[model samples]
Target: MANSPQSKKRARQAVRRNDVNKARRSRIRTYLRKVEEAIASGDKAVAQDALKNAQPELMRGVTKGVVHKNTAARKISRLAARVKALG
Candidate 1:
């Protein structure tokens, strides 16, 4: 419980930030899922396109502080490798 006015304000802000972050996370997951599905379908072209679209969104998540930079990098790296191996 926030006893002080400032703490209450912070609590409110945190709730708002949490909602935004949740949405961002969901969006990122959707993008990742698209790439996964494309890869799973064994279509290199579609997978490459999906990866192309997902990369910026992932990086955007990193920049917005919703995702860690290294985590995003690792994901991109792994996905790229999978797409490369799809040939």
Candidate 2:
């Protein structure tokens, strides 16, 4: 639906950015899922390790604009609390 040449170029660029961002989002979700599964296993050590690994990945996603800072922080906080309560 982009008529002008510039608009078409912008649209194309947006498509590429969307694909990259989608991949980043998926990667972040996978990291989060790992932490969740580790927690569900009731192994504090494994859950802690998974949370350690996921923290940086989630922060990276924030910096890349794929995830919001507060959202990531809230998720980390909640997951940490759950992991702590596992004992």
Candidate 3:
């Protein structure tokens, strides 16, 4: 379908970018899940630590264009609130 050389090159680039983005998204989800599990387990200290580790990953996702800035902010805010409530 990509008849032009430029289009073919773009398609190839897109495939590579897609793989990279997918991996990034998966990594972000894994980090978020760690925080969630920590919270669910009701271990405030572990949750706090997980949150600390996840905050930067989430922000990195935003900076890398995997997630929106406000989205990451909201997630961090809500998770922080939940972690605080555990106290």
Best model number under lDDT: 1
lDDT of 3 by residue, 24-58 (tens): 88998998999999999999999999999999999
The weakest ten consecutive residues by lDDT in model 2 span 34-43
RMSD of each: 0.6, 0.7, 0.6
> Which residue runs of candidate 2 sit more than 4 Å off their true CA positions?
none
The TM-score of candidate 3 is 0.97
lDDT of 2 by residue, 1-87 (tens): 999999999999999999999999999999999999999899999999999999999999999999999999999999999999999
TM-score of 2: 0.96
TM-score to true structure, per model? 0.97, 0.96, 0.97
- Candidate with the larger TM-score of 2 and 3: 3
* Number of clashes recorded per candidate: 0, 0, 0
* Worst lDDT 10-window in candidate 1: 15-24
Arranged by lDDT, best first: 1, 2, 3
> In candidate 3, which residue ranges exceed 4 Å CA deviation?
none
The Cα error of candidate 2 at residue 42, in Å, is: 0.4
Q: Name every residue pair that clashes in candidate 2.
A: none
